[model samples]
Structure formats: structure tokens, C-alpha cells
Target: MSARARRWPLVLLLGGTLLLSGCGLFGGDEEEDPPAELLKFKPSLQLRKAWSARVGDGSEHLRLGLSPATDGTLVYAAAHDGRVAAFEAGSGKRRWAAKTRLPLSGGPATDGELVVAGSSNGEVIALRAADGKRRWVGRVSSEVLAAPAIGGGLVLVRGVDGKLTALRQDDGSEAWFVQQSVPRLSVRGTGAPVIAGNVVLAGFDNGKVAAYEMSDGTLLWETLLTPPRGRTEVDRLVDINATIRVVGEDVYVVGYHGSVALLALESGQVLWARELSSYNEFALDFLNIYVSTETSEVVALSRRNGREAWRIATLLNRDVSGPAAWKNSVVVGDFEGYLHWFNAANGELQARMRAGSKRIALAPLVVGELLVAQSEDGKLYAFSERGKR
Candidate 1:
């Protein structure tokens, strides 16, 4: 294989820093340049406090993935201590609460009528949205660390053991299951499966992209994202964060500790690859791919060719979360409890707010006119860009 082909697995897991290894001690730290002035566009996005409420008693040191889910009117979320709550999206008032004994390590995903969530102990639970009552509970062998993907009347889930299973949406029945080999050293898995057309796509630490048929669970195609490092770098197994996205025929995937690449889904061909020296997930806003680095730098790249569009350095170091797009604005939350909104056309600071809380991973979801975020400290905050208009 050529050098680019051999570097595929490493790039998928650790970015370009896979060669240096161990928290990227000897990696490159080049600063990114801001985009041209023509790309500058103002973002009228801001966070507005609607309502706030404490649901279940969450545990400390449990980096549980319990992000709030919304249906434009009500927000549904799972708690660290195994509690599911429904809230009024606008007021943040509690509507109903359903308690489960399993610690919810995964976030909640909704399918119009039913809300689904996973546990650290290989359990999948479904609840009625209106009453917050238990509908069904499905169990698997491995623990679930990622959120389930709901679409086409089915729920697609990827577990920590590198197992992908499709569950029935109505009663949590097992529709199909497929297992793949796990990497020797893997990060805490957090990538959710994304459905594109007739296939379900997921990222695994083994450095491969597996696509399965949505209806019968038949293996459609499995493409190795990269090759293993030779004996010279055996400890460097491919590790990914599970943020796989598909736009039309192109699939964009990035994992922790590796590089990011754009692949043609039709033939599993790598169109372009770039050394992104970081492990942050990417947000696609129909135009550009927005990514954040662990060293607190934000960058925007062209989706077609992996070319740098813009870059900016922030004060954040360890809390550099990824970016999300809303309207004409791109928003990101950092470990310092601050939410920053930038212009999507260009990399310019637009608005920011100190959301208050640090020991949490912050992610902003721009739904309709509401910018909803889940603080690492276990709080759901809402904001709006009304004043910017």
C-alpha cells in the first residue's frame, strides 16, 4: 500500500499526531489563519434563559452522555442516576419523570412518539413520550456508551464492544446484530451511528467504517478507515470519537487521536485526507466542516478538498468542544463553561456567554430559534439570538 493508504487507520483514530502518540507530545502545533474578509458574516445567535430544573441526582466522575433531546416543544433527557425526564422546551419545566435503575451512560434519542436511551450495563429502554412510562427494555451483552440513532422506524445502536444492533422502534425487539473486533486500546466510545439512505454507518476503534443494510441487517459494505501501525508503532491502534456524518454521496468521519478524511460512500474511495492534529468532532453546515482542537483552536475546512478555510485560537486548552451550526452562525462550547458563537461565512467572533459550570462537556444544539446545550455539570441551558436582530 502507498504511504497515504497505510496512514488511513492512524489518521482515522488520532489525526496526524498518531506518529507522536501519548497525548501528542511531539505533534505539530501550527496556528491557523483566519479566512478572507469576504467570508465574514454576522451571526445573530445568542442564548436566552427560558427555564431551568434539576431532574435526577447525577453522579460525580460519571462522564455520562445524557444530552437533552427536543421535539420543538418538549425536551427529553436521561439522567446519570437512571432517570428520564420530559421538559417544556421553552420554560424548562418538568413534565414527567420515569426512573430506571441502570446508570444512563448514553444520551436520549426520540422518534416522534417514543423516547429511547441506553445504559452502561447493556440495556436499552424505551418510554412513552406523553406519560414518560416504561414501554420496553432491551438488553445486549456489551455496555452502551453512545446514543442510539432513530430513523426509518428503527433504532440503530453501537456498543462499547464494537457491536452494532438494530432494535425495533415499537417494543425494543432485536431486529439484527453484528459484531466486529475491538481495538486493544480504545478511548471511551462516544460516536453514534448515522443512517444514510439504505445503510447505517458507524465508526469503530478497529479503524474501519461498516455500513449495514437498514432493513434486514445484511452487511452492505465495510471499509477499513486505515491500516495498523507496523511493529514500530504497535501501541497506536485506531481510536475514533464516533462522529460520522454523510452528506449526499460523501461521508465525513473523524476519531480521537487520528486524522480526518472525506470518503466517497459509493465506492469506499478516499477523496481527500488532512492532518488535523486534534480529536474534536466536526459539524457540517452545508458549506464547511467546523472542528476544534484539543489545544483550544477552532478551524473551518472546505468539505470538497480538505483545504483550510479559517482558523482561530481560543483561551481554552482542555475544554475545546466541537462546533455546531444554526442559521448563519456556528456555535461551540468549551470546558470553561463559555459558549462562543461565530459567523459561519467567516471565522469571526460574534457573541459569547459564560454558561457557568466547568466539569462537563458542553455541546450546543441550535433547534429552530432555540440554542440548547447540556453543561458538563448536568444542566440544560437555552439561549436565543433575539437581541442580535
Candidate 2:
């Protein structure tokens, strides 16, 4: 990857003195080339704030994956301070809340039967969806950074140490665990395991995506999506921290400093690959794939052939979150708590709003006619179209 494609800012030394971050960490003078200022655009969609609630004491800007989740009826959210809560999907009324005191950081994934959340300390807890009662607690080998995948009567937790542990959904006992060889220097997060049919798919720090049989944990197929290269550890980084998306029998995988590729779900054959890098999550609809690139460029690619369709770079260098596909638009949050909506067909700015004062780090969730997003300070906001209510 070229320096321009680098996700993280490069530190440079000139004339025996390190360039201070404020002066030029962005590869130019900060004053002269600041993040693209939010521009004025005519409103095409009137964004309305529907309801807002708090989940817990907030993530304190740790960038944890405590996004809001839903099972078509209720919204589930977790906080870094060990608070998990469920709300009525439409009215935003609190259903139940629990205090696990385990530094909840990863989840709140629901299967409409059980709600599961993981901690920064490698602990997984499942709660009864009916009353928020604790059901079972399972242990893993590393910090669980992604939402646990629940399917086939099992909970698959993606560990930061490149391991995926399957626990029994009934009692939280270990069913199986698979550890992949990790690179010495890699990104800190892991892609959540995706369950499809009888197979569980996961990406690793070494830039490979593998599938395992859900029943017996047998290796089914593995494909190297990103091949590490260059001389330094940072240059060779190829962590696939982005969430893997599956549509029917096709799997979508993207890695940091690597390429985004579509693979055959059963045979691990590469169908199409595009040179795009993202550390954040992605959203897809029937025809297009939305991705937030490392430098905060929201891009749309043709889902069928991996061709570029559109890109919105007005928010570059702003630490933007991944894009979420809502009705006819793509929504993304930035470090400053602003959510920008773009036309799904042509990338035109449709609408923008400030959901909160703190950063919104996760892709917003879509439930019914409302769009839900969680900020760093544990604030959950649901937005609607002007006439959605």
C-alpha cells in the first residue's frame, strides 16, 4: 500500500527533530489542511429525532463495539461500564436493564431468545431476553471485541487474540475453540464471526478468512484475503477487523491495508477483489456495498462485480464511522457526533444532523421505520423521516 492509502497517520522526522502531531501529523500543516469542513447543503430529507435514551456510563472514547442491536421488535444496547438494556423497538421504552460489572465492551447481540454481551476481559454473558435475567457466563482466552455470533444453539465469540470460542447457548459451556496464527504486529480488533447455515465464518489478524463447521468445529475452507507485504511491521499489517457480510452463498471480507474481496462461501474461491481498506464495519443492500475507508471516505461499490459506484470524500480525516443503508440513503457518524446522510444512488448529500455531542463510533441500526445510533457517551438516538412517525 502506498503512503496515501495508509489508514493511520504516519510519523515523520525531519532535520533530527520529530514533527509534532499538531503541526503536521496529517502529512501537512494542520491549519492549512484541516479535516474537510462541513459544507452547507440543501436538505432533501428532513431528519427528525424520534427518541433518545442512555444505556450506561459510556465507553469513555475507547471505541468499543457497543452498538445498538435488534431482533425486529426490541433494541439491545451495552455499555463499557457493564450495563445492558433493552428498549421497545418503536417507542424507545425501557424493557429491562442489567448490571454485569464485567466492563462490557463488545456486544448485545440478540437472537430474540437470548441477549449476549462480552467484556474487555474475555468474559461472555448471556441474558434472558424476557426479563433481562442472567442466564450463563462463559470464559475465553482474550478480550472479546466483536459481537458474539449466535446460531445453531451456540455462541461464537471473536477474541482479540485471534481465537474464536464456541459456547453452548443453553448453559454457556465450551463447545470448541479455534486459534489462528496472528501476526506479531496487527490491529487491536477482530471481525465478528458470522453464522450462515451450518458454517461459522471469521477473519483473522493474518488477513485470512476461514469457515468452520458449526456442529463439530471442523475446518471447512480458508482463503487469504490480504497478503502482508513491505519491510516494517506497520507496513505488513493486514488485520481484517471489519465485520464480514454474507448474502446468500457469497461472503464479503475487507482488511486493513488490504483488499476487499468476495469469496465463494462453500469453496473459499475468490470471486472478485477490490483494493480498499477499512478497519470499521460496512453495510450492504441488495445492489450496493457501503464502506467507510480508513481515511474516512464513505464509498459505494457494485456488490456484484466489485466496481466503484460512488464515493463521498467530504468527511475525510474526520474519524467517520461506517455507513448504514437506510431506506434510500447511506448514513454515517463522525468524531464530532454529526450524522451525514447521502443519496444511495449518486452520493449526493441528502441530510445531516447532530445526534449527540460525543462521537458516534458504530454504524447506526435500522429498525422498522426508525434509524438508531449509539454514541460514545452511551446515548442512543432514534431518527425518523419527517413523516415517519
Candidate 3:
């Protein structure tokens, strides 16, 4: 497609399919842009706060990807301003705090003894999990947008410049780095890679998901998620930025502006591919794949075949937070700080909770029956089921 045609289709998708809320208009200006009908949700489950804490400040316009870390007894979380806090999981009492003084954009990964995280400045730092002390710091050539994946005694890091570097877990020495081609027009890079049985699976911005032999960095298989469609300029621009999801031998990935696909781990054969957009991430239950759109709608699809199962119009026009999976439920946070719990099987709203006056950064995580959430304004909160109702 031509650039003019591509811009018009994106404009139509944004203008025709999205709105802030599913409500009736109350004024003449509001009437010009009609509101979508608000879907009524009966209260099926309750949410309670087990504990709360303030981690760090966050950016309002950009998703910072700083999710809380837990080690059964100790919880580790980072502030947008660069402070890593360790708290007792049972009491939520502050245990220790490490000073980074730089933006910690990604979440921390645990290697048992140390927790590793990357800063926007391209430095990968390790901190002692016991007392929040600095372990080692390594530098990549470009920005580190996603969290590091520690698997098979190798620390896998992806740089914004489209390089996947494998580092030795014990030392910060480089094991291997593969330079992959990046999408020409992408604003961000790929998400965290996943460790399959013997492969380190990663998705790239150029619509290819490749699995490499973790030990030797040899390319085992590479699968295209959004293969060229229409054979035009815009078709060549189609990109995939899904965080690789590995379940058994099947790898699940979503395209940012293209499609959601399931690929075979061994053969790199695409099992099923469907249109779905998730700039952030997706939540997967055993059988269902929950994806959120830039239009603020949550669409559920069959994980096996990529069939549409259900859709919930969140009606939120702003970019949506990611979806988190909790047993039979899927919970998503919005930019307005509202937390929504939906039926994972059908996309039905079950409960809603408010984190604070500010916006939540990403999807709320379910840790030991409690939902942990953080706001952009530097407040961390917890939610749980009220009781068996």
C-alpha cells in the first residue's frame, strides 16, 4: 500500500473503532463524537488490598515496565527515579533500598543470588538479593527496553539496536551477540525473550521470531509472525514486537500493528495467525490468549487455533495497560488507575478496583492470591479477593 493509503487505514481504525468510555453523550460537543454503550457488569468477585508500598515515580505518557519482583519472603521493586526497594512480603515493611540514580525502565530478573535489571542508559546492573548491594554492571551498545531473561546459566539481553547478547550468569562477560535486523519505522524494540526447553526464543521488531541454541547461539529456527501481506510498501513495514510466550512446544507471539501468531518451537511452522495489536503485552491462561489493543479493547482468542473467543470494549481511548492472568481470571489496568478483572474465558467484567489517583504502569500481577499494582505517581498497592461470596 502507498503511504497515503496506510495512513488512512490507521486513521479509520482509530477514528471508527475507539472511544474513551461506553457511555451516552451529555452535551452537544460530546454528541458529535457519540459515546459507546457502557456494558454493565455484575459483581462476581471482590478485591481487597493485602498490602501497599511506594516504589518509584513513573512517566505518564510512556509505559516504564517496572514490575514488582518477589522471592516468596522478600519483594523487590524499582522506582522510575532509580531506587530499588526490598520489602518483606508478609509485612510490606521496607527492608533495603538501592540507589541507581538513573531511569530503571525494565523489570528485574532473578538469578537466585542476584537480581538483574537494565537502565535506559544501556547499562545492565546486578544487585545482591540478600541486601540490595551492587554486584556487577555491564553495558550494551544501545538502550535496553525489555527485561533480561536469565536461563540456562546465561543472561539474555536484547538491545534496542536489535542485538541479542548472551552473557555469562556468573560474570558479566559476553557469551555471544547476534545482530538482527530492526523494523525501519518502529519506535521501540522487542520484549523479553523466553527460555524454552533447550532454546532461547525471542521475537524481533522485523516480524521474525527466532529460536537460538542457548549454549552456542546458533540459529535453530526463525518464524515470521506477520508475513508480507499485500506485497506493498506498507506490507514491508509490517512489524512484530510481541514478547515471546512459550508453552510446551508452541510459542505464542503478537504483532504490534499486524497479527498474533502461534509458532512451532522445533519446526518454526506458524500454527495460527490472527489480527491483534498489543504494544504492551498479553496474558495467557491455559487455553485462552488475552490481548489488549491500543484502542482499549480486550480481545480473547483461542490459544490453540487463534480463533476469536470474545471481546470486551473497555472503551478507553488512551493506550491500555497489559493484561495479567490469575487462575480463571484476567485483570488489566488502565491509564486512569482503574483495575478491571474479567473472565478469562469470555472477556466478561467481574470486578473493578482503583489503585490510586494516578495511572497504573502495566498489568497488575497476582502474587499468592493478592494482586500487586503500582501507579505512575510512585505508589504501590495490593488487591485480593474479599472472600468466598
Candidate 4:
């Protein structure tokens, strides 16, 4: 078989294997053990449900880029069925709902005035935040798998086709497009571009992260976070599927079968790197970085250097979402629809809650003292510490 054909197992292994049916890593014939049952744990912190509302039929099986976006007062969420709803952040009451009539694949990015979403057929739709009225629609080159980001008067989108297209936020006019070479075989996700001042930072399937000038898509600098290795295409896969995280003047990013590196924001220089592989986005606090490894291990590393702080390995092979830091604890969701909280200082389990019957595929959004989570079954829930109430 050709190299590309041989890599199909790896693509499926990384993307849909765990979600659909349990498949052995690298297509092995061994039967895998089922995920471990939730261990009984003592509660150190109490979490109570504040409220929850239905968005629509959630992403279902499409794994669309539907995540809740918030702007202090309101929260926005989209369903795969093209229904977008805005809710009051405090009360969880529906503000308005808009129907784009297109298969929504990405977004709910808001600049407080306009909210943008992407369709499965490459259409970018913008709606007025005040009421769910259609503002404008633009087109990109391919399917959008990441949430659209708005900043610097431009709405930026990263398409599966390796193109980063920026549209004028006011009228949805094309501003500029930046293209990169895509590997033949890659994991099934895209890293959403992040805007820092006048620069747009984006990661590609080729394992490279590049910085571009937001004004005209001019290339500022590019660095290879992971270099493909091994003989077969499957072994050579190194997609940087995780969204880049920018803290202060440094950028933190990881790849599928690659390393996690801290890069200087202005010069794209690698400050430090450690051999680690993860596709899930990470969370950072003042002292440490929390990441969910591909094997479902949640690890904490020192922010000053890439030294290991702590790791929780009992959740391995469970398909957990990225970590999100809330208050004094770090939170993560799993395929079994449960949210697990751990103490930030030590990796000890502190609390757990079930948000839905289906998987909680994305990290819970942290809005002040409230934790907002969207389940795969279309349920949006808000939670807060029991002591706060």
C-alpha cells in the first residue's frame, strides 16, 4: 500500500476511533480495556448548578466547532443544526435565537456588537448581538473546523484547507488570505487563529505555527513546532491541532505527536520545549500550565520552565477535554459526560459532576466565578461554587 493509504489507520485512530468504537492504537488486533469506572472521591470543593438551557440539537456526530462565547453580560452558543442563541450570563435566560438555515460548523465569536459563525459549506455568517438578525455572510475556501476569532476590525477563520482568511467585520468583505501546505494525512481538527494586537497567530496541519500581520496578511514569522518523523506517513504525522495560547509576551502550543514549546511573541523564537503530544488546548495559571495528554492524562507543568509539576493518570484512554483553570482548581470534561475538577497546586481530584448524558467534548468556559459547559447533546449548563451562593 502507498504511504498515504497506510496512514488511514492513524488518521482514524487519532480522530474518530475513541469517539465511535474502541479501536486499538495503530490498528493493533489486541482488545482494549474499557475505561475505568469513576472512583469514589471525597469532595474538597463544592460545585452547584446555577442554571442550564438548551441550545438546539448539539454538534451530534459532526463534532462541529460549537463552543460558548461570552462577553461578561451575555453568552452565545451554536448548534450543528444552524441555530444560534444568546443568553444572559447571569440568569441563563434566552436573549434571542437566530436561524442561519445553513449547517453551522463553527463559532459564536462576538465583539459584543456582532457575532460570527461558520457553516459546513464554507459560509461565514455574522449576526447582530442585540437581536439575532442576519448582518452579512461571506465565503471561505473550505470547511471551517475552528471557532472564528474577531479582533482588529477583522473576523479571522482557519479552514481545513490550510487557508486563513480574514474578513472585514463591518461588511464581511474579504481582507486577505494566508495559505500553508497541508500534510496528506492529519488529525481532524483546526487550531483557531488568535489575535494579538496587529498580529494573527495560527497553527497548521503541517506542525508549523506562523504569525501574520492582521492588516494585510503579511508574513511576520513562522516556526516549526513539530517536525514530522518516521518512515510511514502515519508515524510521520505531526499536526498542531491545539489552539495556540498566548500569555503575556510568550506563546504556548502543542502538536499531536510533537512537543510543547514556549515561543517569544515578537520574534517567534522558541524559549523552551519539552517532548509531549497533545491535541487538546491547554490552560495556564500564574505559575503552571495544565494540559490533557493524548492518552487522557492531565498534567501540570511549571510555567517558568518546562518541568513537570504533577500528573493525574487514572483517566487514561478516557478521551478528556482540555483543562480550564477556575478559581483554585483545574477543570476537564470526559467522553462519559462528566466534569472532573482537580486542585491546581497538587493534581488531586476535588470535585466531579455530570453535565449531560452525552460527551462533554469541549473544555468548560470560565466566566468569572461561573463555569459554563455545553454537552454534545445540546445542553448548556452553568455552575458555580457552592460557597459563593
RMSD (Cα, Å) for all candidates, in order, is 7.3, 4.8, 6.7, 4.1
Alpha carbon deviation, residue 127, candidate 1 (Å): 0.6
lDDT for position 373 in model 1: 74
Q: What is the lDDT of residue 12 in candidate 2?
A: 24
Residues 60-126 of candidate 2: C-alpha lDDT, one tens digit per residue: 4465778888999999999998989999978899999999988987988999999999998889999
Scored by lDDT, the top model is 2
Q: Estimate each model's TM-score.
A: 0.83, 0.92, 0.85, 0.93
Better of 1 and 4 by lDDT: 4
What local distance difference test score does each model get? 0.70, 0.85, 0.71, 0.84
Q: For model 4, how does the per-residue alpha-carbon lDDT over 71-136 read when each residue is reduced to its tens digit?
A: 888999998888999999888999999888888888778889998988888999999999989999
Model with the higher TM-score, candidate 1 or 2:
2
Worst 10 residues of 3 by lDDT: 4-13
Looking at candidate 3, what is the lDDT of residue 65? 59
Task: Give the RMSD in angstroms, all C-alphas superposed, for model 1.
Answer: 7.3
lDDT of 3 by residue, 44-144 (tens): 98777677887776654444556776776677788768888887766678898899887777767775577888777877888898998987888777667
Off by over 4 Å in 3: 1-41, 228-237
Candidate 4 CA-lDDT value: 0.84
Worst 10 residues of 2 by lDDT: 1-10
Model 1 TM-score, 2 decimals: 0.83
lDDT of 1 by residue, 1-389 (tens): 12221111222133222222222422325333322122243545544565556666654334456677777778887777788888887667788988888778786888658888899888999888898889899976666766788888788888877888998887788988887887645554557888998888888877777778899878777777666664534345565664688999999987554667898877667788776644445689777888876455778888888888888865335345567787777777764566778888887788877666653353566666777777655666777765531
TM-score of 4: 0.93
